[model samples]
Target: MINWHRLFGLALEDYFTGTRYAVEMEKDVARKRQVLDVVIVRGTGEALVDPCDGLEDLRPHNLLTYKSGQESLDAWAIEELIGHYVNYRKAFAPREPAARFGLYAVTTRRPRALAEQVTLTPVKPGVYRLPVVGRSITLIVLREVEPCPRNALWEIFSFEAAKVAAGAGMYQWRQDDHFPILEEIYRRYREAGIPMSYTFQDFRRDLARETLPELTPEERLRGLPPEDRLRGLPPEDLVRGLRTEGRLRGLSDEDVAQLKDLLERGTSRRQ
Candidate 1:
């Protein structure tokens, strides 16, 4: 699986960099004699990062499981992740409340219906939650997430070596509309000295482009209103507004263009 244990550890270490918790991978559960994919423990480092968006605040401890896109997790998977939480509580956390450890399941595929007793709630577009006992288990659906530069999870799609091999067929959507963020993540991976696993070595040979071309300043300014553009304001802000706020307002591109042209002519005549 392209050394998922190493890849996730490297990525999450960076993701939670500066957080109070330390990121651990392939953690052993001596009770069940099983290994966990990842865990976050408090006091691992200095507290420096604000909480990441769409992710809950880090607790004293957290348990996580990761599945490649093709892997279909059933009720058993849920049971297993919860079991890790149970073990974590029994072993590590004592003075803390029951279920002090958080549980996380990150995958590209939508999980099958969970146990009837488990109530899944939507925390965000790509994040779901099940509060069991006194702790919370979060499900991160990678393919369901929208592209954003601010999302720390871009590493899952962009840089996870296992995904390059295991997820190509099923979770291709992970690469869609995320080229910019992906490039940033890839750069970090390279800078961090994390090597691509042998599983992906053959695949990287045929890899075409590393990143897509981002919109230039000229392109961003192209359709902006003369008043806004000539005001020497940030044209990218206008483009962002057009894409997000304007869409919400139901403003069509044609409508925006006509308004820009009208303003351009008005300003030209006055000059």
Candidate 2:
């Protein structure tokens, strides 16, 4: 199962490096009995250059909710987020010029019906804008977004889904091309001083733990006289070991037959 909350929170922090933003993960407002997925506030200090264009408006206070690909973000969810905004203001009431607020909803599934009802504007392929009273909320559908290595958000959001589809199993680790790509993505974040949790070390560890130990075929098992390597072993044990070694080496039927013939001849000679 996907940990949408953690993924979103970590990804946001990885993308926005430095002291420019104060990020609160799973922040709770007691009166509302609601725990926000992620809350980002712009730092009062020097402003940093926006990494992705058009995201400059995400300053002050951004209320973000992440939905897994399996989850749906409907009209009700949207209304609930608006409610969160109201609850947020009540909890942290600003003095004179209140902090600017923006809502952001991110998901991996398509929000067809929801999009129809709201004033949704396309910022990019998978990214949409829903017009609110004061500011617009950004809705990002990960499935609809184009794959760009340079786009940290896209890489982070799409990583798991892609990995599963690619069959990134331990035995098939070499076959998976995404592993390297994911490693590079993490490297970029580390370079910017934001070390993410879903790192290359974690990837390697998982692969190592899950994969069964493999053994190379014994050199004597590969050649002309199979008895040279099979001496002193019981008949059943030798046969079992040979079968396993053969399977691992992907030996053809003919090769097995040749080994069996050699074994039988050696047995007759011994008798």
Candidate 3:
């Protein structure tokens, strides 16, 4: 088996740029960008940042959306990160050099706002890489930790590294303490020759739903309004009420034009 300890250290080394034997840096060091607790906009050759400024600003508005799930940090961290960048404004702007945020997470969810701007690909369970502009970021999921663990509160995803561009923390989540349980669940699945990426959140979801409910097509449509529904309606829904019941079976003029444009140019990459 590979040496997990050495590998862990190596990963950290890569994360911290190149830490020699892993002694924490007290202040920002130019070359050792690997171990920064946070990366602030520079001032007099130093670092200082407002953590709450980013994601916290967006929480009250629907600009930031989140849902509860099995893992604590996994359930919340990505949302918080989204809030952070949403707060950054220029962080994911239309024109910026490629840059990335180092992360530690217990789980991940689809980002709330920047989904269209960044191209995200899964690097590992609980880990992802988001390519924003030309720069790339490494994300890690974590769980909730508390002095009051019994209440099961799930908030809290920030860390020292978040203060810089490379914050990582040992965040606790719902199934974080149940490592043995997860290993066993995965082991049983694999032993039976079923392959799956088993995570703590996956185990918790299984534990929570004794019988999962199924959603049907009509049931799915119930939440959608005629305006929001994608039924090829056109004329900007102004003509919907007048003889528009099943009259507009085809796509809107805009949709057809968009399709034509796609066909003409095809999918091209940025230079």
Per lDDT, the best of the predicted structures is 2
What C-alpha lDDT do the candidate models reach, one value each?
Answer: 0.61, 0.64, 0.34
**RMSD to truth, every model:** 16.9, 14.6, 23.4
Q: What TM-score does candidate 2 reach?
A: 0.55
Q: Choose 1 or 2, whichever is better by lDDT.
A: 2
**Local accuracy of candidate 3 as per-residue lDDT tens digits, 1-271:** 3222222222222232321112122222334231222322211321212221111111111111122132233423454545444443343233532232232222223343444555556664333565543433454332222222221112222111121111111212222244453344334434445444434455456544532355566765786887677677666675656574455457798977787787667655331
Off by over 4 Å in 3: 1-26, 29-110, 143-271
Quote the lDDT for 200 in model 1.
34
- Poorest 10 consecutive residues by lDDT, candidate 1: 167-176
State the lDDT of candidate 1 residue by residue for 1-271, as single tens digits.
2354455555566666666777888888766588888898888656644343345655678788877544665667777888877676767775687545567787756676553546678877777887765656787777665545344343355345644334322222222343333344444445546454533333343332322245567765777788877685565755664655554476678988887899899999999
Residue 179 alpha-carbon offset, candidate 3, angstroms: 21
Cα RMSD, model 2: 14.6
Query: TM per model?
Result: 0.53, 0.55, 0.21
| Number of colliding residue pairs in model 2 | 0
- Candidate 1: stretches off by over 4 Å: 44-53, 113-119, 133-135, 158-271
